[model samples]
Target: MSGSAQVRAWQPGLDGVVEVLHAYFPSHAYPSHTHDAWTILLVDEGVVRYDLDHREHGLTRAQVSLLPPNVPHDGRSVRPEGFRKRVLYLEPDRLGADLIGAAVDQPELLDPVLRRRIEQLHGVLADGREPLEAESRLTLIEQRLRQHLRRQVVRPAAHRDAGVAGRLREVLDAHLPGGITLDEASKLVHADPAYLVRAFSREYGIPPHRYLTGRRVDLARRQLLAGRPAAEVATLAGFYDQSHLTRHFRRMLGVTPSRFARS
Candidate 1:
Protein backbone atom coordinates (compact mmCIF):
# COMPACT_ATOMS: atom_id res chain seq x y z
CA MET A 1 0.00 0.00 0.00
CA SER A 2 1.33 3.41 -0.92
CA GLY A 3 0.38 6.96 -1.85
CA SER A 4 -0.43 8.35 1.60
CA ALA A 5 -1.68 7.31 5.06
CA GLN A 6 -5.38 8.19 5.37
CA VAL A 7 -6.15 6.72 8.78
CA ARG A 8 -7.57 9.24 11.22
CA ALA A 9 -8.54 9.13 14.93
CA TRP A 10 -10.40 11.57 17.14
CA GLN A 11 -12.00 12.07 20.54
CA PRO A 12 -15.21 14.00 19.99
CA GLY A 13 -16.74 14.60 23.37
CA LEU A 14 -16.05 15.48 27.00
CA ASP A 15 -17.00 12.01 28.27
CA GLY A 16 -13.56 10.59 27.37
CA VAL A 17 -15.09 7.10 27.14
CA VAL A 18 -15.44 7.17 23.37
CA GLU A 19 -13.14 7.63 20.38
CA VAL A 20 -13.80 7.41 16.65
CA LEU A 21 -11.65 6.30 13.75
CA HIS A 22 -11.84 6.16 9.98
CA ALA A 23 -9.50 4.11 7.84
CA TYR A 24 -9.10 3.47 4.12
CA PHE A 25 -7.22 0.29 3.27
CA PRO A 26 -6.68 0.44 -0.48
CA SER A 27 -4.75 -2.82 -0.54
CA HIS A 28 -3.68 -3.45 3.02
CA ALA A 29 -4.72 -5.80 5.82
CA TYR A 30 -4.40 -5.56 9.57
CA PRO A 31 -2.53 -8.45 11.21
CA SER A 32 -3.92 -10.37 14.19
CA HIS A 33 -4.12 -8.17 17.26
CA THR A 34 -6.42 -6.96 20.05
CA HIS A 35 -7.56 -3.54 21.11
CA ASP A 36 -7.86 -2.26 24.66
CA ALA A 37 -11.30 -0.91 23.76
CA TRP A 38 -14.33 -2.35 22.02
CA THR A 39 -14.58 -2.03 18.21
CA ILE A 40 -17.99 -1.63 16.56
CA LEU A 41 -17.75 -1.38 12.80
CA LEU A 42 -20.07 -0.39 9.98
CA VAL A 43 -18.93 -1.74 6.64
CA ASP A 44 -19.54 1.02 4.11
CA GLU A 45 -18.14 -0.66 1.03
CA GLY A 46 -16.19 -3.64 -0.24
CA VAL A 47 -15.57 -6.55 2.16
CA VAL A 48 -13.57 -7.35 5.27
CA ARG A 49 -12.66 -10.89 6.33
CA TYR A 50 -12.35 -10.60 10.08
CA ASP A 51 -10.39 -13.29 11.88
CA LEU A 52 -11.67 -13.24 15.41
CA ASP A 53 -10.77 -15.83 18.02
CA HIS A 54 -10.02 -18.89 15.85
CA ARG A 55 -12.62 -18.52 13.08
CA GLU A 56 -12.88 -16.27 10.02
CA HIS A 57 -15.99 -14.09 9.67
CA GLY A 58 -16.66 -12.32 6.38
CA LEU A 59 -18.44 -8.94 6.52
CA THR A 60 -19.74 -7.31 3.35
CA ARG A 61 -21.42 -4.03 2.54
CA ALA A 62 -23.82 -2.77 5.28
CA GLN A 63 -22.79 -5.52 7.70
CA VAL A 64 -21.94 -4.58 11.26
CA SER A 65 -19.31 -6.35 13.38
CA LEU A 66 -18.57 -5.97 17.04
CA LEU A 67 -15.22 -6.92 18.51
CA PRO A 68 -14.90 -7.15 22.27
CA PRO A 69 -11.85 -5.98 24.16
CA ASN A 70 -8.52 -7.79 24.07
CA VAL A 71 -9.83 -10.37 21.64
CA PRO A 72 -7.07 -11.54 19.36
CA HIS A 73 -8.07 -10.76 15.79
CA ASP A 74 -6.86 -9.85 12.29
CA GLY A 75 -8.47 -8.51 9.09
CA ARG A 76 -8.18 -9.45 5.40
CA SER A 77 -9.75 -8.29 2.17
CA VAL A 78 -12.33 -10.71 0.76
CA ARG A 79 -12.21 -9.16 -2.74
CA PRO A 80 -10.12 -7.08 -5.09
CA GLU A 81 -12.08 -3.92 -4.36
CA GLY A 82 -10.47 -3.87 -0.91
CA PHE A 83 -12.40 -2.57 2.13
CA ARG A 84 -13.39 0.67 3.81
CA LYS A 85 -15.04 0.66 7.25
CA ARG A 86 -15.71 3.08 10.13
CA VAL A 87 -14.91 1.89 13.68
CA LEU A 88 -15.99 3.17 17.09
CA TYR A 89 -14.06 2.69 20.33
CA LEU A 90 -15.41 2.63 23.88
CA GLU A 91 -13.36 2.00 27.02
CA PRO A 92 -13.74 -1.05 29.28
CA ASP A 93 -14.20 0.85 32.53
CA ARG A 94 -17.14 2.71 31.06
CA LEU A 95 -18.47 -0.59 29.72
CA GLY A 96 -18.07 -2.59 32.95
CA ALA A 97 -14.91 -4.63 32.30
CA ASP A 98 -16.20 -8.02 33.47
CA LEU A 99 -19.07 -7.89 30.97
CA ILE A 100 -16.99 -8.74 27.89
CA GLY A 101 -15.04 -11.60 29.46
CA ALA A 102 -18.35 -13.35 30.09
CA ALA A 103 -19.66 -13.02 26.53
CA VAL A 104 -16.47 -14.22 24.87
CA ASP A 105 -18.40 -17.19 23.55
CA GLN A 106 -21.10 -15.30 21.60
CA PRO A 107 -20.73 -11.73 20.39
CA GLU A 108 -23.70 -9.67 19.22
CA LEU A 109 -24.46 -8.85 15.60
CA LEU A 110 -25.29 -5.35 14.35
CA ASP A 111 -29.05 -4.90 14.35
CA PRO A 112 -30.99 -2.21 12.47
CA VAL A 113 -30.94 0.22 15.36
CA LEU A 114 -27.20 0.05 15.68
CA ARG A 115 -26.84 0.23 11.94
CA ARG A 116 -28.72 3.53 11.74
CA ARG A 117 -26.64 4.95 14.55
CA ILE A 118 -23.51 3.99 12.64
CA GLU A 119 -24.68 5.89 9.57
CA GLN A 120 -25.18 9.06 11.59
CA LEU A 121 -21.81 8.58 13.28
CA HIS A 122 -20.08 8.27 9.91
CA GLY A 123 -21.61 11.49 8.63
CA VAL A 124 -20.47 13.56 11.59
CA LEU A 125 -17.00 11.98 11.76
CA ALA A 126 -16.27 12.27 8.06
CA ASP A 127 -17.28 15.91 7.98
CA GLY A 128 -14.40 16.69 10.38
CA ARG A 129 -16.18 19.40 12.28
CA GLU A 130 -16.19 20.87 15.81
CA PRO A 131 -19.57 22.53 15.83
CA LEU A 132 -22.58 21.71 18.00
CA GLU A 133 -23.98 19.53 15.26
CA ALA A 134 -20.85 17.40 15.23
CA GLU A 135 -20.70 17.26 19.02
CA SER A 136 -24.34 16.19 19.27
CA ARG A 137 -23.84 13.45 16.72
CA LEU A 138 -20.71 12.28 18.47
CA THR A 139 -22.59 12.02 21.75
CA LEU A 140 -25.35 10.04 20.13
CA ILE A 141 -22.85 7.61 18.63
CA GLU A 142 -20.96 7.28 21.92
CA GLN A 143 -24.13 6.48 23.82
CA ARG A 144 -25.08 3.92 21.22
CA LEU A 145 -21.68 2.21 21.24
CA ARG A 146 -21.84 1.96 25.03
CA GLN A 147 -25.41 0.69 24.88
CA HIS A 148 -24.29 -2.09 22.53
CA LEU A 149 -21.41 -2.91 24.83
CA ARG A 150 -23.75 -3.28 27.78
CA ARG A 151 -26.20 -5.40 25.80
CA GLN A 152 -23.48 -7.57 24.27
CA VAL A 153 -21.31 -7.41 27.35
CA VAL A 154 -18.55 -6.08 25.10
CA ARG A 155 -15.79 -3.92 26.54
CA PRO A 156 -13.41 -1.76 24.60
CA ALA A 157 -10.28 -3.72 23.81
CA ALA A 158 -9.76 -2.93 20.14
CA HIS A 159 -5.97 -2.84 19.87
CA ARG A 160 -3.80 -5.89 20.47
CA ASP A 161 -1.70 -5.97 23.63
CA ALA A 162 -2.05 -2.31 24.43
CA GLY A 163 1.15 -2.23 26.51
CA VAL A 164 3.32 -3.80 23.80
CA ALA A 165 1.49 -2.13 20.95
CA GLY A 166 1.89 1.27 22.56
CA ARG A 167 5.58 1.09 21.88
CA LEU A 168 5.00 0.43 18.21
CA ARG A 169 2.53 3.34 18.13
CA GLU A 170 5.19 5.62 19.56
CA VAL A 171 7.70 4.64 16.88
CA LEU A 172 5.11 4.94 14.11
CA ASP A 173 3.98 8.38 15.22
CA ALA A 174 7.60 9.56 15.53
CA HIS A 175 8.48 8.37 12.03
CA LEU A 176 5.19 9.23 10.24
CA PRO A 177 6.98 11.75 8.00
CA GLY A 178 9.54 9.11 7.04
CA GLY A 179 9.43 5.33 7.54
CA ILE A 180 10.93 2.90 10.03
CA THR A 181 12.32 -0.59 9.44
CA LEU A 182 10.41 -3.34 11.24
CA ASP A 183 13.74 -4.56 12.61
CA GLU A 184 14.51 -1.17 14.14
CA ALA A 185 10.98 -0.80 15.49
CA SER A 186 11.14 -4.28 16.97
CA LYS A 187 13.96 -3.11 19.22
CA LEU A 188 11.76 -0.39 20.62
CA VAL A 189 8.95 -2.85 21.31
CA HIS A 190 11.44 -5.34 22.79
CA ALA A 191 10.36 -7.98 20.29
CA ASP A 192 12.58 -9.95 17.95
CA PRO A 193 12.47 -8.89 14.32
CA ALA A 194 10.96 -12.17 13.11
CA TYR A 195 8.53 -12.27 16.00
CA LEU A 196 7.55 -8.71 15.28
CA VAL A 197 6.78 -9.69 11.71
CA ARG A 198 4.66 -12.63 12.81
CA ALA A 199 2.94 -10.69 15.58
CA PHE A 200 2.12 -7.71 13.37
CA SER A 201 0.77 -9.99 10.68
CA ARG A 202 -1.25 -11.92 13.19
CA GLU A 203 -2.56 -8.87 14.98
CA TYR A 204 -3.02 -6.30 12.22
CA GLY A 205 -3.43 -8.63 9.17
CA ILE A 206 -0.73 -6.71 7.23
CA PRO A 207 3.05 -6.93 7.23
CA PRO A 208 4.92 -4.23 9.11
CA HIS A 209 6.93 -3.19 6.08
CA ARG A 210 3.77 -2.65 4.05
CA TYR A 211 2.26 -0.67 6.86
CA LEU A 212 5.30 1.60 7.01
CA THR A 213 5.34 2.07 3.28
CA GLY A 214 1.62 2.91 3.31
CA ARG A 215 2.12 5.43 6.09
CA ARG A 216 4.94 7.10 4.17
CA VAL A 217 2.78 7.28 1.07
CA ASP A 218 -0.04 8.79 3.13
CA LEU A 219 2.26 11.49 4.50
CA ALA A 220 3.55 12.29 1.03
CA ARG A 221 0.00 12.74 -0.20
CA ARG A 222 -0.75 15.21 2.57
CA GLN A 223 2.39 17.19 1.73
CA LEU A 224 1.65 17.11 -1.98
CA LEU A 225 -1.95 18.17 -1.34
CA ALA A 226 -0.53 21.19 0.43
CA GLY A 227 1.29 22.11 -2.82
CA ARG A 228 4.72 20.68 -2.06
CA PRO A 229 6.77 19.54 -5.08
CA ALA A 230 6.58 15.80 -5.76
CA ALA A 231 10.37 15.40 -5.69
CA GLU A 232 10.67 17.25 -2.40
CA VAL A 233 7.69 15.47 -0.85
CA ALA A 234 9.05 12.08 -1.92
CA THR A 235 12.31 12.48 -0.02
CA LEU A 236 10.56 13.98 2.99
CA ALA A 237 8.13 11.07 3.02
CA GLY A 238 11.09 8.58 3.00
CA PHE A 239 11.13 7.64 -0.67
CA TYR A 240 14.59 7.15 -2.20
CA ASP A 241 13.38 8.38 -5.61
CA GLN A 242 10.31 9.94 -7.18
CA SER A 243 9.83 6.91 -9.47
CA HIS A 244 9.74 4.69 -6.38
CA LEU A 245 7.06 6.98 -4.94
CA THR A 246 5.11 7.17 -8.22
CA ARG A 247 4.94 3.41 -8.72
CA HIS A 248 3.50 2.81 -5.26
CA PHE A 249 1.18 5.80 -5.51
CA ARG A 250 -0.53 4.48 -8.64
CA ARG A 251 -0.72 0.96 -7.27
CA MET A 252 -2.36 1.87 -3.97
CA LEU A 253 -4.29 5.08 -4.54
CA GLY A 254 -5.19 4.30 -8.17
CA VAL A 255 -3.69 7.63 -9.30
CA THR A 256 -0.36 9.35 -9.74
CA PRO A 257 0.83 11.42 -6.79
CA SER A 258 0.38 14.50 -8.93
CA ARG A 259 -3.22 13.61 -9.67
CA PHE A 260 -3.98 12.97 -6.01
CA ALA A 261 -2.25 16.22 -5.14
CA ARG A 262 -4.57 18.08 -7.46
CA SER A 263 -7.53 16.67 -5.56
Candidate 2:
Protein backbone atom coordinates (compact mmCIF):
# COMPACT_ATOMS: atom_id res chain seq x y z
CA MET A 1 0.00 0.00 0.00
CA SER A 2 1.04 3.56 -0.51
CA GLY A 3 2.14 5.90 2.27
CA SER A 4 -0.35 7.86 4.33
CA ALA A 5 0.45 10.86 2.14
CA GLN A 6 -1.09 9.04 -0.81
CA VAL A 7 -4.41 8.50 0.96
CA ARG A 8 -6.96 11.08 2.10
CA ALA A 9 -10.20 10.71 4.03
CA TRP A 10 -12.82 13.02 5.51
CA GLN A 11 -16.33 13.30 6.86
CA PRO A 12 -18.54 15.25 4.54
CA GLY A 13 -21.44 17.59 5.37
CA LEU A 14 -24.01 15.10 4.16
CA ASP A 15 -25.53 12.80 6.75
CA GLY A 16 -26.20 9.85 4.42
CA VAL A 17 -22.55 9.59 3.39
CA VAL A 18 -20.42 9.47 6.50
CA GLU A 19 -16.88 9.34 5.07
CA VAL A 20 -14.95 9.72 1.81
CA LEU A 21 -11.67 8.04 0.88
CA HIS A 22 -9.21 8.22 -2.00
CA ALA A 23 -6.31 5.81 -1.83
CA TYR A 24 -3.65 4.04 -3.85
CA PHE A 25 -2.16 0.71 -2.94
CA PRO A 26 1.22 -0.15 -4.41
CA SER A 27 1.67 -3.53 -2.73
CA HIS A 28 -0.48 -4.07 0.29
CA ALA A 29 -3.00 -6.68 1.31
CA TYR A 30 -5.80 -6.03 3.76
CA PRO A 31 -6.63 -8.44 6.50
CA SER A 32 -10.22 -9.48 7.08
CA HIS A 33 -12.13 -6.54 8.51
CA THR A 34 -15.62 -5.29 9.20
CA HIS A 35 -17.19 -1.85 9.04
CA ASP A 36 -20.30 -0.40 10.61
CA ALA A 37 -21.15 1.45 7.40
CA TRP A 38 -21.77 0.36 3.83
CA THR A 39 -18.83 0.83 1.47
CA ILE A 40 -19.48 2.16 -2.04
CA LEU A 41 -16.25 1.47 -3.90
CA LEU A 42 -14.87 2.38 -7.33
CA VAL A 43 -11.48 1.48 -8.75
CA ASP A 44 -9.96 3.96 -11.18
CA GLU A 45 -6.86 1.92 -12.05
CA GLY A 46 -5.75 -1.71 -11.77
CA VAL A 47 -7.75 -4.58 -10.34
CA VAL A 48 -8.70 -5.36 -6.75
CA ARG A 49 -9.29 -8.79 -5.29
CA TYR A 50 -11.53 -9.04 -2.27
CA ASP A 51 -13.26 -11.56 -0.02
CA LEU A 52 -16.75 -11.15 1.41
CA ASP A 53 -18.61 -13.70 3.49
CA HIS A 54 -15.83 -16.21 2.75
CA ARG A 55 -16.40 -15.88 -1.03
CA GLU A 56 -13.93 -14.40 -3.49
CA HIS A 57 -14.66 -11.41 -5.71
CA GLY A 58 -12.88 -8.99 -7.98
CA LEU A 59 -13.43 -5.27 -8.62
CA THR A 60 -12.36 -3.41 -11.73
CA ARG A 61 -13.05 -0.13 -13.53
CA ALA A 62 -16.02 -1.72 -15.28
CA GLN A 63 -17.97 -2.12 -12.04
CA VAL A 64 -19.23 -0.41 -8.86
CA SER A 65 -18.95 -2.43 -5.65
CA LEU A 66 -21.31 -2.12 -2.66
CA LEU A 67 -20.16 -3.84 0.51
CA PRO A 68 -22.81 -4.17 3.20
CA PRO A 69 -22.34 -3.14 6.85
CA ASN A 70 -20.88 -5.42 9.51
CA VAL A 71 -19.83 -7.96 6.88
CA PRO A 72 -16.30 -9.31 7.17
CA HIS A 73 -14.21 -8.56 4.09
CA ASP A 74 -10.65 -7.98 2.88
CA GLY A 75 -9.13 -6.42 -0.26
CA ARG A 76 -5.85 -5.90 -2.09
CA SER A 77 -4.43 -5.22 -5.51
CA VAL A 78 -3.98 -8.23 -7.77
CA ARG A 79 -1.22 -6.43 -9.70
CA PRO A 80 2.15 -5.11 -8.55
CA GLU A 81 1.16 -1.56 -9.50
CA GLY A 82 -1.75 -1.95 -7.11
CA PHE A 83 -5.00 0.01 -7.50
CA ARG A 84 -6.22 3.56 -7.11
CA LYS A 85 -9.73 3.92 -5.77
CA ARG A 86 -12.40 6.28 -4.43
CA VAL A 87 -14.82 5.17 -1.75
CA LEU A 88 -17.88 6.55 0.04
CA TYR A 89 -18.65 5.05 3.39
CA LEU A 90 -22.42 5.40 3.60
CA GLU A 91 -24.52 5.04 6.70
CA PRO A 92 -25.71 1.46 7.32
CA ASP A 93 -29.42 2.33 7.49
CA ARG A 94 -29.42 4.00 4.08
CA LEU A 95 -29.57 0.58 2.35
CA GLY A 96 -31.58 -1.14 5.09
CA ALA A 97 -31.37 -4.70 6.44
CA ASP A 98 -33.15 -6.61 3.67
CA LEU A 99 -30.68 -5.60 0.98
CA ILE A 100 -27.67 -6.95 2.91
CA GLY A 101 -28.37 -10.53 1.82
CA ALA A 102 -28.59 -9.57 -1.81
CA ALA A 103 -25.32 -7.64 -1.45
CA VAL A 104 -23.57 -10.68 -0.02
CA ASP A 105 -24.74 -12.69 -2.98
CA GLN A 106 -23.87 -9.99 -5.51
CA PRO A 107 -21.52 -7.34 -4.20
CA GLU A 108 -19.98 -6.55 -7.54
CA LEU A 109 -22.38 -4.69 -9.84
CA LEU A 110 -21.70 -4.11 -13.54
CA ASP A 111 -24.11 -1.25 -14.17
CA PRO A 112 -22.89 1.60 -16.35
CA VAL A 113 -25.64 3.90 -15.02
CA LEU A 114 -24.53 3.25 -11.45
CA ARG A 115 -20.85 3.66 -12.26
CA ARG A 116 -21.50 7.04 -13.88
CA ARG A 117 -23.69 8.21 -11.01
CA ILE A 118 -21.09 7.18 -8.45
CA GLU A 119 -18.44 9.05 -10.40
CA GLN A 120 -20.58 12.18 -10.45
CA LEU A 121 -21.30 11.83 -6.76
CA HIS A 122 -17.60 11.67 -6.02
CA GLY A 123 -17.04 14.79 -8.08
CA VAL A 124 -19.56 16.82 -6.08
CA LEU A 125 -18.30 15.37 -2.81
CA ALA A 126 -14.84 16.61 -3.70
CA ASP A 127 -16.13 20.08 -4.50
CA GLY A 128 -17.76 20.10 -1.04
CA ARG A 129 -20.22 22.83 -1.99
CA GLU A 130 -23.06 20.70 -3.34
CA PRO A 131 -24.58 18.85 -0.45
CA LEU A 132 -28.04 19.24 -1.98
CA GLU A 133 -26.93 17.65 -5.24
CA ALA A 134 -25.08 14.94 -3.34
CA GLU A 135 -28.23 14.02 -1.40
CA SER A 136 -30.33 13.92 -4.58
CA ARG A 137 -27.84 11.74 -6.43
CA LEU A 138 -27.62 9.44 -3.43
CA THR A 139 -31.41 9.10 -3.34
CA LEU A 140 -31.52 7.91 -6.93
CA ILE A 141 -28.55 5.61 -6.42
CA GLU A 142 -30.27 3.91 -3.52
CA GLN A 143 -33.37 3.48 -5.64
CA ARG A 144 -31.41 1.71 -8.36
CA LEU A 145 -29.65 -0.47 -5.79
CA ARG A 146 -32.93 -1.50 -4.19
CA GLN A 147 -34.27 -2.38 -7.61
CA HIS A 148 -31.26 -4.60 -8.14
CA LEU A 149 -31.64 -6.28 -4.78
CA ARG A 150 -35.39 -6.84 -4.95
CA ARG A 151 -35.39 -7.70 -8.66
CA GLN A 152 -38.45 -5.51 -9.16
CA VAL A 153 -39.30 -2.05 -10.34
CA VAL A 154 -39.12 0.58 -7.64
CA ARG A 155 -41.64 3.21 -8.62
CA PRO A 156 -40.60 6.83 -8.74
CA ALA A 157 -42.14 9.07 -6.11
CA ALA A 158 -45.52 10.57 -6.90
CA HIS A 159 -46.33 14.29 -6.90
CA ARG A 160 -49.50 13.93 -4.88
CA ASP A 161 -48.09 15.21 -1.57
CA ALA A 162 -48.36 18.93 -2.20
CA GLY A 163 -49.78 19.56 1.26
CA VAL A 164 -47.02 17.57 2.91
CA ALA A 165 -44.43 19.32 0.79
CA GLY A 166 -45.81 22.74 1.65
CA ARG A 167 -45.81 21.93 5.35
CA LEU A 168 -42.27 20.59 5.23
CA ARG A 169 -41.08 23.76 3.53
CA GLU A 170 -42.56 25.78 6.38
CA VAL A 171 -40.80 23.57 8.89
CA LEU A 172 -37.51 23.97 7.04
CA ASP A 173 -38.03 27.73 7.07
CA ALA A 174 -38.50 27.60 10.79
CA HIS A 175 -35.28 25.65 11.32
CA LEU A 176 -33.07 28.25 9.53
CA PRO A 177 -29.30 28.73 10.24
CA GLY A 178 -29.25 25.80 12.63
CA GLY A 179 -30.90 23.65 9.95
CA ILE A 180 -32.82 20.58 11.01
CA THR A 181 -31.47 17.13 10.22
CA LEU A 182 -33.27 14.87 7.76
CA ASP A 183 -34.67 12.72 10.53
CA GLU A 184 -35.92 15.73 12.43
CA ALA A 185 -37.48 17.23 9.31
CA SER A 186 -39.25 13.95 8.52
CA LYS A 187 -40.53 13.63 12.07
CA LEU A 188 -41.79 17.20 12.14
CA VAL A 189 -43.62 16.68 8.85
CA HIS A 190 -44.86 13.15 9.56
CA ALA A 191 -43.19 11.60 6.51
CA ASP A 192 -40.40 9.18 5.74
CA PRO A 193 -37.02 10.85 5.20
CA ALA A 194 -36.74 9.68 1.59
CA TYR A 195 -40.39 10.42 0.93
CA LEU A 196 -39.93 13.91 2.36
CA VAL A 197 -37.06 14.58 -0.01
CA ARG A 198 -38.96 13.22 -3.00
CA ALA A 199 -42.12 15.14 -2.22
CA PHE A 200 -40.29 18.42 -1.57
CA SER A 201 -38.34 18.05 -4.81
CA ARG A 202 -41.44 17.27 -6.86
CA GLU A 203 -43.43 20.17 -5.50
CA TYR A 204 -40.73 22.84 -5.46
CA GLY A 205 -38.61 21.74 -8.44
CA ILE A 206 -35.58 21.83 -6.08
CA PRO A 207 -34.30 19.71 -3.24
CA PRO A 208 -34.93 20.77 0.37
CA HIS A 209 -31.26 21.32 1.04
CA ARG A 210 -30.91 23.54 -2.03
CA TYR A 211 -33.85 25.62 -0.94
CA LEU A 212 -32.21 26.15 2.43
CA THR A 213 -28.95 27.12 0.79
CA GLY A 214 -30.73 29.65 -1.39
CA ARG A 215 -32.39 31.16 1.64
CA ARG A 216 -29.06 31.45 3.39
CA VAL A 217 -27.53 33.10 0.33
CA ASP A 218 -30.38 35.55 0.21
CA LEU A 219 -29.76 36.48 3.83
CA ALA A 220 -26.06 36.89 3.20
CA ARG A 221 -26.74 39.22 0.29
CA ARG A 222 -29.01 41.43 2.39
CA GLN A 223 -26.52 41.63 5.24
CA LEU A 224 -23.58 42.26 2.94
CA LEU A 225 -25.38 45.18 1.30
CA ALA A 226 -26.05 46.57 4.77
CA GLY A 227 -22.24 46.92 5.16
CA ARG A 228 -21.64 43.90 7.39
CA PRO A 229 -18.20 42.37 6.83
CA ALA A 230 -18.08 39.06 4.94
CA ALA A 231 -16.68 37.20 7.93
CA GLU A 232 -19.40 38.46 10.24
CA VAL A 233 -22.17 37.98 7.68
CA ALA A 234 -21.13 34.38 7.21
CA THR A 235 -22.48 33.19 10.55
CA LEU A 236 -25.27 35.76 10.68
CA ALA A 237 -26.44 34.44 7.31
CA GLY A 238 -26.31 30.75 8.38
CA PHE A 239 -23.05 29.68 6.71
CA TYR A 240 -20.40 27.81 8.67
CA ASP A 241 -17.73 30.47 7.95
CA GLN A 242 -16.52 33.10 5.48
CA SER A 243 -14.97 30.64 3.02
CA HIS A 244 -18.09 28.50 3.12
CA LEU A 245 -20.19 31.53 2.28
CA THR A 246 -17.74 32.61 -0.40
CA ARG A 247 -17.82 29.24 -2.14
CA HIS A 248 -21.60 29.13 -2.42
CA PHE A 249 -21.84 32.84 -3.08
CA ARG A 250 -19.41 32.68 -6.00
CA ARG A 251 -21.09 29.57 -7.36
CA MET A 252 -24.59 31.00 -7.25
CA LEU A 253 -23.97 34.65 -8.12
CA GLY A 254 -20.87 34.37 -10.33
CA VAL A 255 -18.84 36.55 -7.91
CA THR A 256 -17.38 36.36 -4.46
CA PRO A 257 -19.40 37.81 -1.59
CA SER A 258 -16.95 40.70 -1.21
CA ARG A 259 -17.18 41.46 -4.91
CA PHE A 260 -20.94 41.14 -4.79
CA ALA A 261 -21.09 43.68 -1.97
CA ARG A 262 -18.84 46.04 -3.94
CA SER A 263 -21.14 45.70 -6.93
User: What does candidate 1's lDDT look like per residue over 1-263, in tens digits?
Assistant: 32343555455553433556566666776655555567777777777886776667877665567677656666777777676767776665555556565335444454677688677766766675745666576567656655655565444655565455546656776876666777789878898878766666655555556656666765675577567889988898888889999987766655578766654
TM-score for all models, in order of appearance: 0.53, 0.57
Q: Which residue pairs clash within candidate 2?
A: 1-27, 1-28
TM-score between model 1 and native = 0.53
The lDDT for every candidate, in the order shown, is: 0.65, 0.79
lDDT of 2 by residue, 135-205 (tens): 99988988888888787333443446878888887887788777889999888888999999998776655
Off by over 4 Å in 2: 1-5, 152-263
Off by over 4 Å in 1: 1-55, 60-62, 65-109, 117-130, 150-169, 181-192, 195-205, 221-232, 253-255, 259-263
Q: Give candidate 1's root-mean-square deviation (CA, Å).
A: 7.5
Instruction: Give the Å error, residue 86, model 2.
Output: 0.6
